[model samples]
Target chain A: MLPGFPHAEPLAGLAGGILIGLAAAVMLLGSGRIAGVSGIFARATGVASSSMPRLAAWAFVLGLPLGALLVMALNGPLEPRFLSLPWIAVAGLVVGVGTRLGSGCTSGHGVCGVSRLSPRSLVATLTFMATGIATVAAINALT
Target chain B: MRQRLTSEALVALVAGVLFGAGLALGGMTDPARVRGFLDLFGNWDPTLAFVMGGAVLVMAMAWLIQPRMIRPLFTDVFNLPKARDITPRLVIGAGLFGVGWGLAGLCPGPGIAALVIEPLSAAVFVATMLVGMVLVRLFEKDA
Candidate 1:
């Protein structure tokens, strides 16, 4: 694991943010589609179709793992904190609902929406972020 | 459809950087933190919500400004998805996402974002997520 920071490293976070912005911009500019993860995932699964969009979507999705592999190869090894299978399955279900409800996942609204400056995206993004925040708060309160 | 390769590459690079930075700063790069937030009915970490809120604030500003400034970047016009009241699809998708997130503590963007810091689990989460996406597509096609 990377060295843990005391409060959250602004530099590290900034770097991460830059990467997301760059990725979204590139996907749009090059492929002419928003780098929305749900859409990408849907297309990859064949639930949705758009030849060029699908290719780019696949590339983006595949690149994610490839990038992780590169990091793992270099970093030695990393282990995720384990959670029960049922819990993981449930979490997946919630996120799926949220994505559909919000009309886009974080990648689409949070990244692409902000970049393109869409009002509807703004509201949806706000709702998403808010809901996420509330969920965390409630989770924390109960736990 | 064709543009200068260099410019396209630059866009991709920038988007990636921004995306990565956001994940890192939001504390989303850490599954432990995500778990903490989801452990709400249990441990109750509430920080993720705040981070999401901050992101929404930035997005809100962008939404207000985008249409006024840029008519359209690549497409003839920016296409907005139809605004539909929350439906069963929304509920189902969000619920699935939450369950996965609570268990795995990683959403697609943040999960992929974690690659910069952690690799193994991130890889697993991303792979499974893709599988889920593909499954959705296959089922949809059959329907």
Candidate 2:
């Protein structure tokens, strides 16, 4: 679909996204929880509290990387890079703080909440998308 | 209770693994791919939009099923977010998250999923992100 970006895999993206949605659906139906990564991480780390059991939270967190490793073992290695060290650290810190304070991330707000037409999530998604676009624009201009 | 807890945790593991696989397959695990999507003004990659659209479409269906069911399959009650107010804190936090996402092209989910894909980089980001979470708890007693 993207002519400008030849490497842009639309089909893969769509399929993958569907799988993600299914994952969230499973979490909602089976455990009655939003698959908000930040929240799960927080609960596992004891930074947050909820009806979720700690063991469940830990299981989910551990499962994340194991799944990735599974993918690599099957499809070969993936080459994913970071923004060097300094910038990545800064980005990580800001994202962590922002997600906790805002009470959701891409999964919680962008996928689950937005689909349900929640007003707060709608606003949050719009705000983050706009800011994310603007920030990328600014970075491109500066660099 | 122990048996129930085990079931809950196993369900969570399945969801988490599916989520991680989806992220990697959809190309969200790649910072470059995510940045390309964010780089709207530059070589814009529309793959992320397709991913978002597909996920949202599926999630909307899941939401339709949510209200009819009193409780989830394994859990007694649903534990979704309830607050709906559009607050300054939410906007600010989301905006900051956008900045971080644009800068590193790594949000909470992708950041964690990339642990096995890009070990060193993902670890740094996750560690700093954890510290950021801790800082929030330390500074904001209300949080």
Candidate 3:
């Protein structure tokens, strides 16, 4: 277990994973769409568009915060410390562009795409995981 | 057609809600938890591995069921990615996203879900991410 955090919540984490899977299943079965959050956000925000319906994209993006709010009401808010605003802003910028250019992220490539056994998603997941680990190590080492 | 569109939007909203709620319950919305998962060389917390395992297991089953279906329930076509090539864009973009994720401990889904939990920081991240995505779009269009 990592220090400076609460005890590991494996059960909660697994339960949440199942819920996320169910959500992805719903999207795939109901709409034949990948539940890729970055892509959906881009579509909703008009940064990117293809054949996806704009209304559905908007609805999905809007619902993300509502679901989070519901969880907060039930279990109380999550206390996540962040880096300084300037640094976080820069990171966010990179994430936004990177996810767009890469064509997926945790939800899109990691969960949905990997399950489908897409080689592209697999490679992307591996790439991101490696870099994510490296970045964390670098940060811990430096500070 | 209008009725179908409405149902599609509703389904998308429900999917997003479940996805966000899962992210919260699974501790993905917590930067500490996420960072712990990434800190493989440190006092690593392996709970997120279980989370991903559980999600991937369920989604794998979904992929099996997907192929059996004639088409999606709401839409006429299944909008799935067909590209299998691992392009430089995928590797580089995923690497960049990984850096940002490690630095901020948030991805698109969690970043959006944390809007209520850490409104200011999350907003900054999301806003900058959007700008980044838009910049990519502009550059791509020019290219």
Candidate 4:
């Protein structure tokens, strides 16, 4: 456990993971779609088109915050520190372009794809994990 | 047709809410926590592994069911991605996304969920992300 934020909640993490999996399962079983956030975001924002209806995409998008709100209602406040707005913009811009080009993000590739044992998703997950670790290591060294 | 559409939207909304709540519960909505998890070389937070483990385990089970379903409940056909080959684009794009993720600890799902937590900054990040995605689309069209 790291300092400043001690008590790593593996139980919470596991429970949350189960919820995420259930969400993905619901999506796959109900709508026959991947619960890939970037894909849904793209379709919702008219950046892409697919068999999933635009209305459903928007509904999914709206529900995200509502769910967060529900959790806050039950569990109280969350303490999440964000980067400065400029840094955030840079990061977000890169994420958007990358996810679009790559055809997925963490949820799409990491959770949903890896579970399916899709070789492409496995490759994508491994690539992102390696790069993410390397990037953090570089930042840690510089800082 | 209208009823089916409504059900489809409802399913999507429920799935989205669950996804968002899971991220929040799993301690993923916090960028600092995520960054800590990424910092494998320095003070690591390994609970993220539990989150991934739980999610993947559950989703792996879901995949088993998915293969047996004739059709998803709300849709006529399943629309899962069928891409199989690994390519430069996948590797490059995933690498870029990982960098951005490490930089801000915000991927698309958590980025969107952060709307409730940090509205202004989240708005900026999300806006830039959309712009970047659109730019990629434009570039793709040109290419």
Candidate 5:
């Protein structure tokens, strides 16, 4: 039998989901911006603009690590088996290229785009997801 | 004049929480699990597909409610995009994103959410993502 209540981790995931929804909604209402990660990250890089949106984006980005710090303080540090820096760098470069080509990242298109029901977003999302599924398959085969 | 917080921000916050909770609960925050799923050719973990299915179901519900709701919490009118045709940009972007996700096993939301469990990788991913966004803004002015 599964342990009682399925495990606290799952509950934590539920809470995290609620937080994401709330953050997106709040950012839209308060700042008149979609909490799209690509847009925010774009602005933070000074490529978009240096307005309040950019400032807010910076805050949100910075807050991510801060939040993690808080969590670590409360729950103890995570023991990560760090992947090689070279692999991580390559991954980052690819993601950068993809986001630019896609017009948005998963957060922008996957979460917000799907919520808005844009056919383009839907199609784009499907493509990425299928790719992701395939890539996983391929990687496993190689390794 | 006091600047009232917009409903959008509130929405984003809630959504973010939900997203984070989902990551924590769904075991997506665990890099090892994510890597395992990406190891499709090897271990071929298929759990992520179920998670995506759950998200899609929620999205379907949102679609049903969106039209009837009429007014958005902040805007007088709900803003839907006018374009539906897929462009070259969309296809290329999706492809790139797939490559990155396949290699890294990280997407924006889950990536940011993963900070709670894996700070270093999350930080690097977010930072590099921001840089990519900036570059797009700088070079894609005509776009």
Candidate 6:
């Protein structure tokens, strides 16, 4: 295990993942939608419209914080340390545009699409993984 | 008709809650944990991988059940991505997203979820992200 870094929480990870899947499943089976946050955000913000309606999109967006609150209630609040504001802004811009251009993010492509064995999602997932790995490696090396 | 919308909205709210909770519980809401997952060359944490795996496994089952059904429970039709052929937009977009994800260790889901945890920074990232999405929409329209 890596020193200083927390040990991998396989159980919590798996449980949380199952919950994610359940969320996706509930959306798919109940609403016939992909629970992709970027897409949902776009829809919620009136930037884009998908098969789902705007009202429903807003509901989902609002639930995100509520759900996080639930976790905090059970496990306590998390204290996250983010990068500098400028760097974060840059990253956010790229991600927003990229996800739109690409058509999906981790939730849509990585989880929902891949689970369905979608070729496009597969390619997108592979591409992102490769680049994510490379980008992290570069960042680590440069810093 | 109004009742239908309300039900769908409720479903979406519940799904969003689950998705957000899952993200938090799985540690995806933590930027450091996400970055650690991407840090393959260094002290890499495999927690996110398990999270992804568990989510995929369950969602796969959902896909299996989807094909058997004529329509989704709430919607009249299932809205799924139709792109099959790989294209430049997909690859380039995915690449850009990966870079941004690595740079900030944040994505759409976690970014929103983190709003409650780190209000100011997360808000900055989310605001810029919305701007990016709007930029893409405007560009696509002109093109």
Candidates' chain A TM-scores: 0.82, 0.94, 0.93, 0.94, 0.82, 0.93
What's the true lDDT of residue B113 in model 5? 63
lDDT by residue (B1-143, candidate 4, tens digit) is: 89988999999999999999998888888888888889998888877887889889988998999889999998888999999989999999999899889999889988888799778877887898899899999998999
Per-residue lDDT over B61-130 for candidate 6, one digit per residue giving the tens place of the 0 to 100 score: 9999998989988778788777798999999999999989989999999899888988888898899999
CAPRI-style docking class of model 3 based on DockQ:
medium
Per-residue error at A9 for model 3, in Å? 1.3
Measured as a fraction from 0 to 1, the native contacts recovered by model 6 come to 0.82
Error of 5 at B82 (Å): 3.8
Q: Report lDDT per candidate.
A: 0.54, 0.89, 0.89, 0.90, 0.60, 0.90
Query: How do the residues A29-140 of candidate 1 rate in per-residue lDDT, one tens digit apiece?
Result: 4434566766666666565664434444455655554544443465454444545455544555455445644456767766666545556565665555445555655655
Native contacts kept, each candidate:
0.24, 0.81, 0.78, 0.80, 0.37, 0.82
What TM-score against the true fold does each predicted structure earn? 0.64, 0.97, 0.96, 0.97, 0.73, 0.97
Q: TM-score of predicted model 6?
A: 0.97
Model 5: native contacts recovered, as a fraction: 0.37
| Of 4 and 5, the candidate ranking higher by lDDT | 4
Instruction: Give candidate 4 regions above 4 Å deviation.
Output: A1-6
Best by lDDT: 6
Interface RMSD of each: 5.2, 0.9, 1.2, 1.1, 4.3, 1.0
lDDT over C-alpha atoms for residue A141 of model 6:
97
**What TM-score, to 2 decimals, does candidate 4 have?**
0.97
Binned by DockQ into CAPRI classes (incorrect, acceptable, medium, high), candidate 4 is high
- For candidate 5, what is the DockQ? 0.34
Window of ten residues with lowest summed lDDT in model 1 chain A: A1-10
Error of 3 at A81 (Å): 2.2
lDDT of 4 by residue, A65-109 (tens): 877888899999988888888888998999999999889999999
> What's the true lDDT of residue B34 in model 3?
90
TM-score of chain B in each prediction: 0.84, 0.96, 0.96, 0.97, 0.85, 0.96
Which candidate comes out best when scored by DockQ? 2
Judging by TM-score, tell me the better candidate of 1 and 4. 4
